[model samples]
Target: MSLSARLEHHLQASGLPFEILTHRYAATALENALMAHVPGDHLAKSVLIHKEDGPMLAVLPANHQLDLSRLQSMIHHPIGLAPESELEDLFDDCSPGAAPPVGAAYDLDTIVDNSLSGLDKVWFEAGDHRTLIEMKGRDFDKLMQDAEHGSICVH
Candidate 1:
């Protein structure tokens, strides 16, 4: 699928302009960036973390790694990466490793890295390995206005 039904609904409802770019099959965030000809720092990748309350989505640049210690301290809860088995249930509409960063669309809490702020634009997976959604930085900010923001990644 080009996009998750939930994500498509959310995107349209936001009234924000977004472009869907297709690329060769990619298995990882970095691969997605390279295949799409987008800078790794400008491609947002989402990691699902198992938290005390429930699952949380952490968004950061494709080139960075999630700082678990920093994230736990910020959220005040112990967290671990959700296993591959759990992803399908949480993101039933997405490909095995391609989870979109818009947690709100999936009914989950999200925390975005501050590093993405002030960027000119950003790209992210669109529920599949071969399609990417692109949007302006300001539009991204507006879309994620309700999500928490902090430093949660390391090079």
Candidate 2:
């Protein structure tokens, strides 16, 4: 199944209202925001981190950069970026660089940057290079309820 398909299933099962925005293929989260004509700050990007114990997802706005020091402090362990090969194997249903920020879809722990807390709406990859999933901020919060929230990024 493709990323969009899996997302659709998950959203439908959860009964959340959302819209799927399609755009030209993009290889990066910032490019996806540009192609979708959404504010970069409202586009959430997922960065997979490999810790000694396992993997976790770090989600932040497309315009922000992950604050590794802050994350390391919060996680209390050193974390490194997961290689593309690892992502490919872990997110087999999605494109190489298009995994959704909602890590629950792939059964991984998730941590979201507090910077995204107040956006009225948020956009993120739909598991492919050409699709975006848009949802209300409340819905985003609900979707990520199980994920930890912290100051994990720097503007």
Candidate 3:
């Protein structure tokens, strides 16, 4: 599969300039960075989490680890990682391990790590293992306008 139809629609409808980047297939964010020759810190990784309300997406740098405690405190409730099965059910249009960081495309709330704010550009999986979507970091923030921002991770 290529980029998810919903993601394409969201990006196009948002009118934020973006580019589709093709690279060797990769199963993890770090592998995607290596294959695409981009800095790990510039690659946004999507981690799915569940809260009492519903599912949420945590977008962070590929080189960083999600700090569960920090995220929980910021959200003021317990949250835990969503399993691969849940990911499959939620992102059926995409391959395993390859969901775009733009959670709004899937009607889910997103949380962006403040660490990503310093990045000049951002790259993330485009719903498949062999492609990424690239855009200016400011544009990314625009795409994530509804997302909450906090120090949700540590490198």
Q: Which candidate achieves the best lDDT against the true structure?
A: 1
For candidate 2, lDDT tens digit of each residue in 1-155? 23456667788878889988899988899999999999999999999999999999999999999988899999999899999898888888887888899888888899999978878999999989998989999999898888999999998
**TM-score for each predicted model, relative to the true structure:** 0.98, 0.95, 0.97
lDDT of 3 by residue, 1-155 (tens): 87898899999999999999999888899899999999999999999998889899999999999999999999898899998999989999999889889999999899999878856999989999999999998998888878889999999
Ranking, TM-score, top scorer first: 1, 3, 2
| lDDT, each prediction | 0.94, 0.89, 0.92
Better of 1 and 2 by lDDT: 1
| Ranking of candidates on lDDT, top first | 1, 3, 2
lDDT of 1 by residue, 108-133 (tens): 99999999878899999999999999
lDDT at position 40, candidate 2? 94
**Superposed model 1: Cα runs more than 4 Å off:** none
Q: How far out, in Å, is residue 77 in model 3?
A: 1.0
Q: In angstroms, what RMSD does candidate 1 have relative to the true structure?
A: 0.6
